[model samples]
Target: MGEDRREDMLDALHRLAEELGETPTTTEMNDRGEYWASQYQNEFGGWNEALREAGFEPNQVWKVPTDDLLNEIRQLARELNQTPTKEQMDDRGEYYGRSYLKRFGSWNEAVRQAGLEPNQRISQSAFREPPDACRLCGDAPDAGLDFHHWRYGENKAGCYLCRTCHDDVHAGGMRPDNDPGWLMGAVENLIRCHAKYSEETSVPAITSRYNIPSEGLVASAMSNVEM
Candidate 1:
């Protein structure tokens, strides 16, 4: 039954991608698909992986510069008017908390590096506390709650969540590598830059700038500009 369901899902995903003429967003999948997007996320590691299985282009987050990430952290700290807390980051940060930890050893270390006091420290018990209330869904003490990793792997951050929300979070997966919004923004900027550059110059100039010999390669690059 699991194998059959997987096949059905792949077929449905390809059909949707074909209908849309581009990869279907998870929101579109949930709204228009026969299967819930969560199911695909559960079966596959992420929605992008599902799209790959369906022979569609995966929604890959492009490579981001480390300086850009650090700058973003500093900007967030400035906007908050205080050192940003891990929980607050869960709400507002552009990048995952683990990215900071991986870059700076710990959240406090990251904050200190950003020239902010680590006064608003994150505690493990905030993840363990009460063991009754769900942080993600705000369930009452009577409702069951579980500890969930906001980021995976060793020494990662976590939070409390109701059972349903916990399952959803796991099934929904995470972009551990890059921020989805930031990646999309980067893609848009690249497209805009490419379009403007092409509009301002001749194709021969573009080919010369990139040192390409064949017009065929230039055509290929133009065709894949959206990607």
Candidate 2:
């Protein structure tokens, strides 16, 4: 029975992917699918896993540059005069708040990093700086480690992951934001400056000198830098 359900879900996902011309998000699948999104989540341990089994790349947040993400969040907050919620982001942001939550560990943390006052649902949690090796496998590869939100959807820090571990967690998924339109010229300048400053300057100093938004942005820029 379980195997039957899995095959059915995979078939459904394949059909949806074909119709959409891309991998459908859980929300997208729920809105237009025969099966509930949670059903897939439950059966496959995660929506991404289901997508993996179905031969589609799951949604990947890391591909989107953090600076681009923060700018949008800050812009939306300024427009709304308050920190935007996930629902609000859905209505207005170019990227989903789910992506922000996955990347930053929580919506509130992403909001705080946007230089906006979060609603304070939880007290501040310190962010774990990117580590040299994959926290799970402890494999230090030549490629810089990727940050993984171990405590996703919460006010807590996450850990580092190498590409292999990152791919496993993401179910070997492709990033959703493949369009190059979001990479504005200013972003290039910000990353270049951040990469140069990251070598010797502290995050605060880099932010002050470049007028960058927050330490989180600096951290993000540094993380993307080639180690």
Candidate 3:
């Protein structure tokens, strides 16, 4: 009887894969599958393994054009009436932000590729370690400094900043409509902060690790920096 139930579950996965003409997600399996996705989880250890047994590819980014993924982001941005932030994407986005980060190196970059403005968030940034003090102002709170993403949604490309500087950068300096001088000054300051905290890391190391494209004008500009 136990073996029969297991066989039934496998059969269900196969049926669903055939019906969908592609691998079905857990949600779709639950909705239209002959057996519960949970049952497959129990029998096959996990969903992807179950898919493997059923002769389908494991769950992964579809082999569609990158533009298709960017289009999804644009569609979400339109619905939000602005570029969608990571939080907004979490709540309503069809695809996961992690996927976008992997594909585009940063969420803000992804937005730019989609021909949209990067959503700016003040008083917030991503950090690898617990922020003990602001990299900019040296203001150390007991609760610690806020992690500020240098670029929106690029948590890896971030540093700690006090609430004040963080707010200021997002509110004006980061905006494309901001004064060009102010933007340049702000960029310089942030680069200094990053250099101080990065412990002699080189520009090429950073660019290579994050898949940052540094060509033409960008390459020339970076060459002037001390790395």
Candidate 4:
């Protein structure tokens, strides 16, 4: 009777594996059967052990059907076929484009509606003047101004900084040993100083004299000093 029961249980396990589209190894089959027996010990106490005692190697007792495995492979292939490719992501303007949309959703929609080039970055020259000094090192240049966000996010009102200063800020300041906040604070103070000077001198002269970036000075003057 015990031998008959063991054969029945092994057959059931093999059928179940076939239905699940998974091929269980001998060790996995044994482990899973034992685990199931252990879980229902109160109702089917020692049944797993009984099967083992009946000369059945639990590991070699079950197998998934080939048809079920093939079905699973087909399903996976279908999923892969439906998934987006890298080219599709680029066409949809993901990543940086997504980030931009998150900040200025309206602008993104407008650009799309107008059929404008998605790859074209905003020209700093479009703005009448620089918003403030370079948020980084406080240097000014003839062109190539970009707004830099202290914290990354959309609609965060980034401060305009020179590329050099911007790189420094991104690098978390020159002092690797010091806290990052120290560099941020230093950059903020420099912006504040530039703002104060912008009030008295020509924007260009103030930038040239102090060797501050035009964007930083402008941004400092316009932005809330408390931040």
Ranking by lDDT: 3, 2, 1, 4
23-55 per-residue lDDT for model 3 (tens digits): 678997888788778878878899889888766
Per-residue alpha-carbon lDDT of candidate 4 for residues 88-175, written as tens digits (9 for 90 to 100): 2224322222222232342323233334322122232223345323433444466766765533444333456687655544453533
TM-score, every prediction: 0.29, 0.30, 0.39, 0.22
Model 3 misplacement above 4 A: 1-49, 53-55, 58-65, 120-227
What lDDT tens digits, residue by residue, belong to model 2 across residues 1-227? 48887899899987765443356777878887778899988888998888888876666421456787888888887787655666667677777666676678766577768887443221122122333334345456787887644233654333455776556544413222543332222223344533442453555644443333356756665565554
Q: List ranges where model 2 is wrong by over 4 Å.
A: 1-62, 120-227
Q: Which ten residues in a row have the lowest lDDT in candidate 2?
A: 120-129
Best by TM-score: 3
lDDT of each: 0.56, 0.58, 0.58, 0.41
lDDT-better candidate, 1 vs 3: 3
Tell me how far candidate 4 lies from the true structure as C-alpha RMSD in angstroms.
19.8
Give every collision pair in model 3.
125-147, 125-148
Superposed model 1: Cα runs more than 4 Å off = 1-63, 120-227
What does the lDDT come to for candidate 3?
Answer: 0.58
Model 3 lDDT-worst window of ten: 120-129
